[model samples]
Target: MAERTSFSNEEYADILFYYGAARGNAEQARREYGEIFPNRRLPDARVFSRTFRRMRERGTVVRYQGDAGRPRLEVGDDEEEILNHFQIDPTLSTRMIARRMGRSQWKVWYTLHENDLHPYHYTPVQAIEEGDPFRRMQFCRFLLNADVEDRNYLKRILWTDESKFDKDGITNYHNAHYWSVRVMGNPHLKRQKGSQRRFNLNVWMGIIHNRLIGPHFLPQNLNGVEYESFLRNVFHELMEDMPLETRQNMIFMHDGCPAHFRLAVRSWLDQHFPDRWIGRGGPIPWPARSPDITPMDFFVWGRMKSLVYATDVPVPNIEDLRNRIINAAQEIQSELTDSRVVKTGVVRRARACNRNNGGHFENEL
Candidate 1:
């Protein structure tokens, strides 16, 4: 576009020349174009000095109040508070401090961003559980423990949990990738109707040195007889058949389920090499809903679900879904165990289970 010059448009001339020239520069963009800028604080004194000197003959830009205008940046009191908090503690990232303050990470980011605190090195990367401080601490603890423990611990310690999967359904957004998309709006998604053959699928999963060990799914309607049998079957498949050395070293740690806590189950556990089975953490006993202390609650399950949801496979049946889930779990372990993954320090915050007890989640609370 050609430059147009007239007394009426003379003031607007700097609008084009200034912005066009400032496609990139050390000088900051002015908050306003004309002499209308109150107080006339130069966006960049150096830029104004250079610009005015160059346009001395052309009269393209006039030196208004001997300075250029400040850009559209506005820093409120809240923004200043965040800036001060960040400046004092260089260790706390935008998301971390945001978590502490019970606020969105982007809110903190915006605070810094408006104050021109955004930079190359201090660039904000998207973090998970960005709003919860306790979870962040939990994630940090998991990393710390993993870093200290040997690879053998992760393997020997079998992490087991019961995941109920519908015959052909999607529970959350994560379950969609593992369900049958063939039927538009899958009807099997709801709870199985009366007298229906609802698959009471129960899986026992374990990991060994970044390798998934077992996931022996229990039979349908597994009662005491079936659960006991399933346990014995799992033992036969993993522990009973393995060499004495392998069975001796392999430690199984499972979540507290009603069936798992049954006296018969405890009897079975005691009978199977007595002290070998995981205890309820000594005499005091581990409390229910303490997911904050568990490794699986934060890292493993969430990562697996994330991967499962991301998968775009045509899950035809439960068999296919199981296979897909296993694959997702494997992928999570593979990605999580990699040296690069751990080094990245992607903390998966500790979660508070009791959200109803006056709801204490954020550090601020």
Candidate 2:
């Protein structure tokens, strides 16, 4: 007897009926089939059993057509439905939308891409208060006016800020990874914990006209008194290397932190820098929560941290971390001296801020 590869719907129904009538016995069903269709060749006994089992399991002996060929890319209603899901909730992930709509994730993703949709990562920005925009606009205009007076005004201002560095340096897991053929254990980063006591160093740095001054270490908990002493003693000494004329003409800038706004600190700025300083209650009021405009905040610290923590090895101790920070600062200083990129960015940011009416402008830049 010949083995059959295909069966019509009527032929399938007859095979299932005969198998059922024979009390689920494949040999009896085959015999019955041969008797009923005397002219037709008998299908293999295994075919009868398989047909019977398929009917019992799926309520039909129809072969599955799902994997017959590659599925055509869906258009019309499917495309409209996928687009509608995104239009309703733009925050929905492709996987989530796929599950909700009973579609494959790749299909949904392809549809989005076909429509020129892209996923944009969210950027964290400082909160702007009710009166912040007005103040920001005012301050940005002040910078612009100063620039008009001197083309090199932005470069002549010393940008300063303090940042903390510790054994557990920043690690962007998104960009850090190891590729392999097989699944492996997650890589661990060692860090100091409680009882072992993690150590942190508060570092202050200044950038002015392609020159970087002191990677000065401040007390862990900086207060008004410590900040005042830093200005009175440490800051002036750091300026010794600058040309006398440049030092006289330079403008000092710091943020509106409580330590920076102290009476003694403001008084020192008034005496030393006179009207050539920008900060809280100084000659120029640096807007609160406005790190977006400062070169130290917007550029230097981020760049230095990336360089300091570029290695996979964890910093062994406070001393090691300090050395890494000093080295990173030196590298940044060399880059600064070679180009006017950072200084030029200050003027560009000032214009952008003014155009935005003092709102967040980093995104626009």
Candidate 3:
């Protein structure tokens, strides 16, 4: 006969500890047991009840050799049912499957592992409309062809976009930490509001090859007039530092945002960039809803936000927030000068988009 598997004395003590902590509730004890010892196989609710009863009546957790109880778990008995549930709904968590099947979570978990099943996170992607993919493909081909004509084509094109920075920036709870020597309430970050209104700063930035431009703060409610003023008055000044050769050869690119589609903006672009600009109705039409191909969207904004909000404390006011953004932009500018990071990424993404027929190609890259 095969030797029987049994719980160790320490395991018995832990069961009793959780049982008492849960006020003798067997189901709660089982849950607490699974949480406290995730790697161990979970005992059924009946096991908890029996263990507690034995502790009270016999004053010990050790079982006699002749004790008659439930038979050892046979995974074969429930493996098919567990796997069937997963086949029907792969999103169902182990806990949900265990509850539905009246089995311990560890049992379902073990069955999954034995069957070579593993969990994967779902990636969020942009929604491609009916014509979006075709447009994206066409633009990607244009970019690839331009690269062939001039190796420095991607490096010379200037990319620009506007993003909003909030006072209460994003927090990744998984990475956030607080250490204490004494017991206390959980520390929290305060999300401050000004007169019942959330505060945010709208700023514009541009990237050309290894150069950074214009951390210019824009009005909260941006419009065509305001956008044109920025382009005429502020944008030209920002580009003055660039080499005459680069400024002359640069192809200005912005997305199909409402402001960029205005007649005034288009006319301004036409006067300045003639047949070189990319936008809603410019010389080269930019694909709508195509952030995956834009350096400003795919790289610059995310990088700047991460740097700006990597703070030990919340930004006190708009001035401090603005300063932090400018500092972050300067830091990114210095980093870009050292490496061809943004240029390389743009070319790689354009190729990936072409390969995927422009239908969400981030995964391939």
TM-scores of the models, in the given order?
0.41, 0.65, 0.66
Q: What 10-residue stretch in candidate 3 is worst by lDDT?
A: 178-187
RMSDs, each prediction? 15.8, 18.7, 14.0
Instruction: Give the winner by TM-score: 1 or 3.
Output: 3
TM-score of structure candidate 3 = 0.66
Tens-digit lDDT string for candidate 3 (1-365): 24333588888888888988988677788998999899998986556666776778778665543334755445867987987787776656888889988999999887775444556443345566789989998998898899899999888889998888888885444422222111112223222222112348988999988888879999977788999999889998989999998988889999888988889999999998989999999899999888879888788888998998897678899899999999999998888866887778888998888887777777556
Show where candidate 1 strays beyond 4 Å.
Answer: 1-155, 166-201, 220-222, 239-243, 279-284, 312-314, 329-365
Give the candidate number with the greatest TM-score.
3
Clashes of 1: 7
Could you arrange the candidates by lDDT from highest to lowest? 3, 2, 1
Per-residue error for 218 in candidate 3, Å, reads 1.4
- Assess candidate 1 and give its TM-score to the true structure: 0.41
Candidate 2: segments with Cα more than 4 A from true spot: 1-117, 171-199
Candidate 1, residue 247: CA error in Å?
Answer: 1.8
Query: Between the candidate structures 1 and 2, which one is better when assessed by lDDT?
Result: 2
How many angstroms is residue 307 displaced in model 2 relative to the true structure, after the best TM-score fit? 0.9
lDDT of 1 by residue, 129-160 (tens): 33444533443454347545754443454445
Clashes of each: 7, 0, 0
Model 2 worst lDDT window (10 residues): 178-187
lDDT of 2: 0.77
